[model samples]
Target: MTLKLAIQSIGVVYGDLGTSPLYVMSGIFPDGIKHEDDILGALSLIFYSIVLIGLIKYVFIVLSANDNGDGGTFALYSLICRYAKASLTPNQQAEDKEVSNYRLEVPSRRLRWASAMKSLLENSKAAKYLLLVVTMLGTAMVIGDGILTPCISVLSAVGGIKKAARSLGDDQIMWISVVILIFLFQVQRFGTHKVGYSFAPILSLWFLNIALIGIYNFVKYDSSVIKAVNPLYIVQYFMKNKKEAWISLGGVILCLTGSEALFADLGHFNILSIRLSSCLVVFPSIILTYFGQAAYLRKHAEDVASTFYSSIPKTVYWPTFVIAVMAAIIASQAMISATFAIVKQSLALGCFPTVKVVHTSRKHEGQIYIPEVNTLLMLACVGVTLGFKTTLKLGNAYGIAVIFVFNVTSTFLVIVMVMIWKTNILLIILYVLTIGLTEFMFLSSVLYKFLEGGYVPLVFTAMMVTIMFIWNYGYRKKYEYELENKVSREALVTIMSNTNIHRVPGVALFYTELVHGISPMFTQYVTNVSSLHSIVVFVSIKSLPISKVPLEERFIFRQVEPEESGLYQCVVRYGYRDAKMERQFFEKVLIDRLKDHIQNDVAPATDKQGEPSDHGIAKVNEESVQKVIGVLDEAIKSGGIMYLMGEREVIASSGSGLAKRFVINCLFNWLKRCVRQQEEVFNIPHKRLLKVGITYEV
Candidate 1:
């Protein structure tokens, strides 16, 4: 798992991080600082931002608390919930007596948030399917970015012509960007799996290039530019160039393209590895490169040939171009991959509808590429390239998604930590403030690029947000249409009678939708029918996990021993990563301990015919048990109630709605067959079936 995770991180997750070299430096600092001294200030600002926000805040602070082993929004939600439950104020700290008498098990903040998301999904049909669609859209946009990133970054680097041709008319760089887009589109058929290997090395080279350049710049120029280390400089800059500073943030924000991916991909890779890679490996290099670019611009101000290009030495020109181009491609690749990850994650979260998730590679969940998404990305990116000819312009339009992904992640984080974790109020406030400050700073940096051409990312993000709302809304309405409200428990009980009860001795599968508490209706019916049962299996399909919940955690179930009401149970689970509807509890089983002490397992298929509980067949025989209600009758009185209890089956609303529909449909068909056979049976739909006569006042 660790090895697979490592390869995925290197191959996909770091694409944007590696590509930070393309326009980050060029975008942030002023072109006027083409001299050594003033340029140092710009360099100072860039590096400082990377270190403070990128490394310190995001990697160390936020990524560290991955729940147990899970990372991302949901994982953190779990931890925050843990924290919230454990969270205690200084003034209101619990006393030993209070602790001993009433220990509060705070519900998991993460779980509840996930629950709300799930409820929204289960309650709405469109909401259930929306997860698939929105994610696929994001995936397309990401691929589009991949193509544009390389051409822009590399061409900008080799483009010494402007500074060479006296910083004027040169469409060569623009043309190259277009060509790169063409190449990126061309390679789609072959798939990225083969060419992907070259990406990490090229990205590494790009980073090494910038790191070396930054070092040389610092050594040769006024080292005091290092004073930008003080967060005060950022404050001072904002104070002086308030508006400019605010807008420039949008550009700086670009440096963190796949920041959201960290949370999204938390399930795939270990938190420590990602954190270390970002802080120690990725951050320093980016900061240095930005500063170096600033240094070069400072020293060569009169040479407005192109602040983006003048940063590197004349001798290393072509090599630098090659490296930069590769980095851009890698950046675009990272965007593409992250898009895939995001879409996959959203599908699992139940935000979109009907997305087919194909596990293209058995190696890792991150390796998947949706065909629909790939083609769409090719088109969107091409549009971006034609619309904005230069990398500088692209930078402006690039960060809208980052701003949104970041804010969403941060919002979820605080919700989990402060309210969920129940952490110290002062600390929670401080953390929230920190995230807010970083957001403000990054947002400011990009404004310079907005009018310069920042509308593109927003267009994409808005499209996504709109789709999400639609999918969620449609689903809720659908559920409202099918839901059957229940009357009081007393009224329900009055309808049950021993005369109506028909019992059996095999297995009775009762399906239901368990909201927050136990279902009162199901409870009443079970007790009213004086039934004797060998095994009463309560089956639930808890479609909480998303379709994107990497393959490893995709299908998991936990079975509890039989509890009150003589019911054995099993629940199947999903996270925000798994997609597609599946019948049967992904190969899990429930056990019956009371009677024969025989263990019970539910096969995905039909149970074997004529097989006693003692012989646990590998497969389920769906045909024979169109309806089997088990009973352990030893008397005439309870026997009538028990034998007659075989009248109805039970189930839960946790499985895929599509899957649930299929199961109930199958059950109904079985009941019809029994009636056709002339066997004495009770054939009734759960929603339509009712208690005989008890009525209650509201």
Candidate 2:
């Protein structure tokens, strides 16, 4: 099973990194190779970058920091948040720690600096916000990569048509790429599982083809290109062409483009599987391909722009081209899928707006389709494809997004090493200087091209960061409002006991974000309508940052008042990767759990003779349980399950600054309007749902 997954990971996890060779050489020498030694320098840099960053840092170190089995920036944040009170969401409770997978390791010896760092993060609001901003920036850049990857990968692959038919114009190739991209995204609705069978085979074939061709080129052209593996060439290349070489780091960074996906997609495969696939299959194939490309470039400098295609043997060019295109599609699909996943995670964590998420596969929880996000990606991808007609410009934008994510991951990884892993401070500093310095160099090169197409990701990231910030801000404020104005148990009793407020004969589920208290929305509803349900369940659907909450631990129930009050608090916990339950199934499960809770509560205590100690008391308890059970069953039979949700309009407090007002009144409000309603998210039937409106000034 592990071997199968490792092979399968080749298509999904390594597609982007594998397809990178199609453009890396071309991107590095866009204007064609200036000096033969420059090829050696470029090769050296690529070799070491893969070894240090890709192999050592990510595959070995970063992968070990995964939150349970999940990876990515959010996963890293979750790790830290789990260890400390750094998360902005106040909803996290002591009960959350009881979750089965919410595991933490205590170091044998705690470092003082680690403790101090955790303290600083927990104590400082600014530090927490900064951490969130950094994570969001990484997430936004990944989304940007989702847009730009397809554009560049497909464009680079399709651009190879010029090598075969020189008569074909650039405009023609661009449109062809646009069409392929459109088609690739169009098939996403079918889910990766539908077409996933072919991805592995195609990608595996691609790697094999590239490896064989690389060896052929090395033997036929110049085998001495193997000497480029020496790190000294990197120094000599830099010393000879300092500024140009520095600038070219932007293109060189592209070699590590899809490396982030390795970590991001960790939830789908185990650490051992990923490590095995990347180290054994991906690394060797890619290194060989780059070396072969450098060898070809050393001899035929003019063909640098189309190095991969130009180097291919004449007999198999068309077949390799076909596989390359397919691999490009696979690569694009992986990133697009990853984007949907992260957005879904963001939504679950309340960092993103509640967009409609379609679970595309029942078997694969990770396979999801967001219509809104998919459409936006399609438009952005098409726009980028047309706007950056040349791979060179697209590479500029692509490199920045990839490297920015790398830098963010590096920052987070360092913190994880210190606080979570409790690694030696000296080793952590070494990691910082080595990986950090390398990424900084790459980041600098990419940022240098900010105006030259790099602004694409920066602009997109700013927009995403703004949306995320506004949504999270509003979400936190509304939660705080609920916390402040939660209806007390006494207040709830008073409302229920009111003579004018008649009790309806239905099971009313008042859906709220509050887990422990009666929602203010419920108070507003009862006050205005002068009615209450005989049985009320305040349902708080909580999404945890982990991948999947265990089924046994899904529903948590607490009685708000005495048994006679018929008010219960049910917290339905879900993990980020867990799909939202259907309304009917969810209600059934809740009712079953409620009955189980009642039965457990009223279970009779036996005497030494194995008889009920208090028969009269047991009878009353049994009758009460039967009565509640009958009411619940009747409600289900008569279709009397009503879902009541709060529709809040958030506004800035009058005492706030102008910016706060604009953010709350304008940006946050507009975002709220754009997202799906709570009723819709819960999949409540229109006839069975009632929305209560409330206003809050934050």
Candidate 3:
């Protein structure tokens, strides 16, 4: 984490928080400007919210609850999944334990309560699904954040135009906002890397200007506003305003909207860089800016509607407005990119539909572009902007998503602290009391506005959660069917030994979901055709819980029987972050490994005529088993490789209830169709692919 990297991080990570002062004051005082005491109280709430939630909880605590270097809702889930045996992915091989992030360091003497919690999660199907739903809810809220952050930030910034020219109407402001949003989303295809360097300097200047202006305002308009820093002011605020103060926390929540970005973007920047940037640059600047705005509002209370724009010293208004707009775009960019990353991770873990993920940076796997998601997000952001048409209204919808995700992250962190970190129980209670209570206050406030645009994110969240549920439920049912119905290894070996069945020419790679044993699809194929390939390879591609698998340990090869069977099984494992290899890369690696295995030791030589002799075919050192590698290599070179995959139509069983039938037959089937084809996902060419369709009942 160099000084340069920290500065760059400020550009990317702090955009939302940096731009909050633009709308936070007006949002809190939407009815009208308040008295001097109320302004001080609002300032107090905003300041402490930043200190408590932003700087302390997220920056210091929740950021540490990441898997390896990754953070976010799924990252926390992945960490817990690795520690406990609660992952929905059932095929856990010994090799998977070797991944870098698989931390198996639980206390040898497990606590009874911790062990019970783990057992309940792992043993009960309903508990496990509930956990998945909880995680998906958090992820969906983040997606909601991606939609709302841009609408509020950009609209608020453009609304400043009205401050300059009082004649500008809402329609003109909306058109300007829509144009800016169009431009912002239009450039997404080029990726953030191309324009990343410029972000640091622009954000740095934005912070410096805000801080300088804040200092100027503090001196010019009642430096006494500094007294609002006391916690007693927060008490005074609630006492003075009662229920209104509690409701106003929804507006105060805006200050901490991007606080999670400090943690979620941890993979892009190290903790030290994020921490230093937050403390040295982001935090001080934002607090002073808020205080400055509060001071300006204290005297010119009538200007509370646009304190951020009006209070800007006339000397630098134009530069500040331009910089604020750029900063808002940068903030929206960070949130959008984070949404893509989360969706990609979800796809790898079988929780999302298989959308096309385009790697934007050759050097960074995390830098990606998803056209489907991008277009959807653009449409949603535009809808929110045009529909709400005001920053205050958008702010009402915005805080709910952020607050919900914050509460989810806090709840999961408590479990991690107790079960994984095994922190002192007393300290854990305090965390729940302090952090949990603060978040609940904000959440309650936001939910109070459910009918007033707050329902917007709730609708989005519900839609996303339904998608995830259908996907995961469908995935689990299919896996269970495969596991229960797969042919035993002995039965598969016997089928291979039946010499009466004709052996065809060329190599056949039967793609299976199972890591071991013959897939039901293979049985279906052989039962129908009554024949086998000259060389049959059962290839299973498994996604592990870790982020990346080391290249040397990716594939595990095993012979299906004694040397002459002409059958083998290859298990190729990938971590969630690993790129799907191209067909050429897959074939090259598989063939090289098979060739090495053939040449390594004593094996028999069997000729095309089935005659066993020392010189009959390419030999290792034994008779009757030879030239297998030669056959496979020649077949691959001649484009004679064929891929056999099972296309399953998941249907409702006769005994399934109506709800289950509807979910499986309706929602899951639709989602399955939207997923990428097996051939494309695994980089297998469709020209040489054969599909075997089966109707699977759950």
Candidate 4:
């Protein structure tokens, strides 16, 4: 991508983070910048906080720890896990398995290991949960932003002409915002492809305008505002009154809420683009604008936040409105895109349940993920807009969740870096201290918004935590059930050979959970005589990335043998992003095998549906057909089993009979309990858990 595209991407994804100044600068002096000292103190807090947290903590320091040239809490976690897992594997395998969770301690610091062990595990989980929740809240903020962006951007732009020369009522702003928002929402269904390219440049120009505005301020103020760069000034303001300054940080720190978005959304934009733009373009603009506002506020305390727009010459109002609209639209889209990214990554990591994902681009597979998420986010945004009524009110409630995640990420990234990579001790220590100080400062600022509007982030965080706990709990519960009952491949084969059962001569499809061991999903109760010469395929399916398997390797199959019952078993696999079952199967080149085993051969080439013109076993060629049956016979006579496994081999079987036990125990119990559950409800045995949201069946 060109620098223009990169800048556009930053303007889009980093918009929320980049445009923190809209509310941030004014937030500091919300009660009006009554004195020169107050204005300068708040300005300095904004400056150094940006330098320490935005520039150093994120752009310079944490961003440097980019894993595989990727950034984001999710990306960092993946790289760190890869790094930590390898080192911990041997130690965990050799040392005590008492510590079920892996620990990240300094290799030589034996003394610190015991003390840090609890902290490491605690921090890792805390960071994971916090990021997950904050990401969700950020997603929610986008919803707030989406509606506001269209409404305010369009309205504010149009609102200027009428308000300046004629009537200045709220109706003009309200009506225009509504009409444009509706138009944008309606066209969203048509998708963004047509104008997406055009939108990119517009977005780049959007940021450039802000950069230019900041440049103008810098040209006017020069280095005079540079004196407002001390941490203690922020401290002294609090020391003087304690109450007012404490609240002031909340507004001041708002400038930096979206700052963390730069890192959280690393997967969307590359490093150089984000770093360069944020420093030279996004950073300076925000700083200069803040200083300009500080200068304006120092000179005009009574007109600080309110009617502050009046301070700018009337000649520039329309341009300001145009820029605001562009920035808002870009910001809104960025948040939506980030929400999409987070969901995709969540599905990949197995932290979220299966959802519909759509790939909109052939150029970049990671370019798109889910439509359902988009629709949901859109709904949330529209709802929040109608509910919150204004962007300023939403801002008061926006940051805590994002900040909570930011601080936690800082803490966890260091631990992750320490565990997974080799870096100088001095740098590591500096990271811990710097990120820590910056995080605490931001958190301190967000507190002021609590009663006024900070409760919004809390609500968002709680919802995220609730969903996270639910997903993780359900996944683990499912895992625990599989762990308790699933059996092994060898045992399955052995059982097939030892039994003298006789029955049908067809394919025996055994439904098993796409999990390790024998899944309890299939029927386990086997008390009657069954057919012989039947190949029992123990099928296991998987969504990729969660398991160790790469998606390309996700669709795997295993063959079962010619046992005493003449049965052959098989298994299948799927990645989360995989296409239809039939398509992926043939694409993987298993057509000949299916033709031979099933004894069916079609025309010269099979169609997309795997349909042969005359569908029967008799269509197979003679020589090739014999080999397929022969292979099956030999497998039956010798091994009596073939193993089916995913990259994770979700179903890990040891011996054949071992699985039979699990089938009999767990699956059977679930069936019986399910039946009883239904019987109690309707006075009849029709319950099967309703099969709601079930990904697979045996």
Winner by lDDT: 2
Q: Estimate the TM-score of every prediction.
A: 0.63, 0.98, 0.93, 0.70
Error of 2 at 571 (Å): 0.9
Residues 217-256, candidate 1: write the lDDT tens digits.
Answer: 7677545666666556666666666675566666666667
Q: Which stretches of candidate 3 lie over 4 Å from their true place?
A: 104-113, 596-626
Q: Model 3, range 49-102, lDDT digits (tens) per residue? A: 898899889999988887777788888887777767777768777767866656
Query: Which scores greater on TM-score, model 2 or model 3?
Result: 2
Superposed Cα deviation of residue 384, candidate 1 (Å): 1.3
RMSD of each: 12.8, 1.6, 4.4, 10.7
Instruction: For candidate 3, give the lDDT of residue 527.
Output: 76
TM-score of 1: 0.63
Candidate 2 global TM-score: 0.98
Lowest summed lDDT window (length 10), candidate 2: 190-199
Per-residue CA lDDT of model 2 for 277-309, tens digit only, reads: 998989999998988888888789898888889
Which should have the higher lDDT, number 3 or number 4? Answer: 3
Model 2 / residue 592 / CA error / Å: 0.8
Two-way TM-score contest, 3 vs 4, winner: 3
Candidate no. 4 TM-score: 0.70
lDDT of all predictions, in order shown? Answer: 0.50, 0.88, 0.83, 0.51
Which stretches of model 2 miss by more than 4 angstroms?
Answer: 606-616
